[model samples]
Target: MDTSPKIVASVVYGCCPTGEPTVPVHLPGRHGGPNRGELQTVNTYPAVPATAGFFTIPAHADYRASAATVAHTRSLSFLKPLMGGPCFDLEAIWDEHTRYEFADRSVEETMATMVDEPYVNHVPTLTGGIGRAKLTSFCRDHFIFSNPDDTALELVSRTVGIDRVVDWLYDHARQTK
Candidate 1:
């Protein structure tokens, strides 16, 4: 039951029937091909019995396979969709959050968009709150209500992923005395 990663000395490339490598993977710090220039095909190899019309080319025993290569092979195109990434539109949900925070400036609306018992932590100023009650208080006191007269945000870039959306923005605010 040891789930920790162990060092691998070689990799095996599974090839399709067309002689094309189904997984054209190269493990870093490990060179391609076997230890000997004489490559072993399924017909010539005996250590591993051929199965399901697939064949493999074993790498050199002295070379070590990188951890990234192992992860890459497991997450290949054929398996990624089956792994169950998010199905909803994360960008639109995030846009609604921002709209509630800035445009509407309604603490109730902002909190409505979040899950129950959600938390926020402003890293720079270290000034957000945890839990439903505390976050609502923080939003009303220090965030939504404390904005300057002309405060606005201009998004520079946005990257949406399966679970989250990251946005780079320009905040335009004018101080008022």
Candidate 2:
């Protein structure tokens, strides 16, 4: 029942449920508002994918105006002020995003371990030339493992039986600290 995030941060391109909020249609011609005397038009999202939960972390400002860019760019344009706070579609997510956040900590921890290994070392420098498989692996591992808070990560790890992930990150970070 508790669907809170395992970690929290100013993420970029967050899900936008407001694009289709169920509001009382009491404004103008649709429900007899000031514009009742004139013609009115309503707006809605077009080209919805199979799922809405899917989205990508766009890295550039120009991409905000176009989804095709995200499809071909194959790069992460971090909205530093927002941190990927907009939502596109499932296909867009599949196209642009390499990493995603789940509600489980163990999943994130496991992902981190996988990403931190030699096979995934080229992720830190966010270049766009990497293959989709490699890029996605980085995304999943980077955010899931590289959280800034220890307490929160621990809480998530314990909740999801990631004792190993917790121990690994803790020990790993401690040695560096």
Query: Against the unseen true structure, what C-alpha lDDT does each candidate score?
Result: 0.58, 0.31
Error at 35, model 1, angstroms = 20
TM-score of 1: 0.52
Write one digit per residue (lDDT tens) for candidate 1, span 1-177.
124233211233443223333332222212232432222222123232333112222353422234323334433432335445435676888899998898889999999988888999888899999999999999999999898757888999998755567799899974559
Misplaced by over 4 Å in model 2 are 1-39, 42-103, 106-135, 148-177
Candidate 2's TM-score:
0.19
Query: What's the lDDT for residue 61 in model 2?
Result: 34
Residue-level lDDT of model 2, residues 90-128, one tens digit each, is 333322222233224354343343323323343457442
Give the top-scoring candidate (TM-score). Answer: 1
**Which 10 residues in a row give candidate 1 its minimum summed lDDT?**
35-44
